[model samples]
Target: MLWLKERGIASVAESVLNSEELDKTVAHLLVAARNDGYAQGYAECSHHVVNALKVDWDTSKSATHGVNTEVALAAAKMQFNNLQLPVMDLIDVALHSEDHVAQLKEIFPDRQEDEDEDLA
Candidate 1:
């Protein structure tokens, strides 16, 4: 409708209007919207958390302290434990799937190389 077009939702309105199963179409749209929102929120939160952690680490007196494996491991463990349930769940899901692991490696090839270097 003209109102939908004015509101910038004309395509969505048209899709719903053209759908044979309006309820299902609406449900699908809702799910897609929710997934998009979750992804966006997750990305924003990740960026914020990473930036905060980086700032804290950079400004900390401990930044000058040479690497201590025990301290680093403890800090990593604490950070992992502090993560939200949703984030932990997503991580678990990804780690449990070979395809997901492969996808992650593909997406973050540098990270994988860093991990390999760490092991070496």
Candidate 2:
């Protein structure tokens, strides 16, 4: 945000950043903690909820009390991780996107391969 502001490209930055797609989920036991004003890593859930609702992370809070995707993605990126921000504006681009997984691979190429293939 600061960097974009400096370059007078904040609008483009604003347009580029989407929070709903940023959250990572937590374990089941952590739900009560967040409800009482505390929540563990809700990345997967948050991402699911946000992605399901198709809302921006910043504004997502307006409709939900879940984790912030934009912040999550920022932290992930600061640690040298790559988060596939929507090229235009679509969460499907992140999940069903062929580019997203590739981007994530740049960081942890060996994180985990698709195990779903075996399930079917």
Candidate 3:
């Protein structure tokens, strides 16, 4: 956000970065993806929620009654790590996505042949 403002891209950044609708849509989509057996989709959504709660813990200055940041973050991370899977169908779908593979390629162009085979 600061980078965007520095670059004079505030309008563009605001339009793209607005999180209210994204949050609602993502929450809905997480369940949908889990039901549909899209592993990464579900995991990504679940991670988002976990991370958000952690952030809330860290940032809630007035919420003295709430759990402290360290404990909250630790719990959130543990829960994220231990979340039960949806169904096998969703797990199968979530484990593989061409888009994700492509992203991996972009990030690690010299990635191994075995990596390609696994994604294939």
* Candidate number achieving the greatest TM-score relative to the actual structure: 1
Q: Write the per-residue lDDT of candidate 1 for residues 1-120, one digit (tens) a residue.
A: 232234324423443355455444455555555555555565556568778777532323433233334444445445444534333344456557767644334332444457799999
lDDT of each: 0.47, 0.43, 0.44
lDDT tens digits by residue: candidate 2, 1-120: 232234324333444553344433222223433433323344446667789998754534543355554555445445434545554344234435566544333322231233555555
- Judging by lDDT against the true structure, name the best candidate: 1
**Predicted structure 1: clash tally:** 0
Candidate 2 wrong stretches, greater than 4 Å? 1-8, 23-80, 88-120
lDDT of 3: 0.44
Q: Model 3: what TM-score?
A: 0.22
Name the candidate, 2 or 3, with the larger lDDT value.
3
Each model's backbone clash number: 0, 16, 3
At residue 117, what lDDT does model 1 achieve? 100
Candidate 1 Cα lDDT to native: 0.47
Residues 26-50 of candidate 3 have per-residue lDDT tens digits of 5555554444444344445656877
Superior candidate under lDDT, 1 versus 3: 1
For all predictions, the C-alpha RMSD in Å is: 25.5, 21.0, 20.8
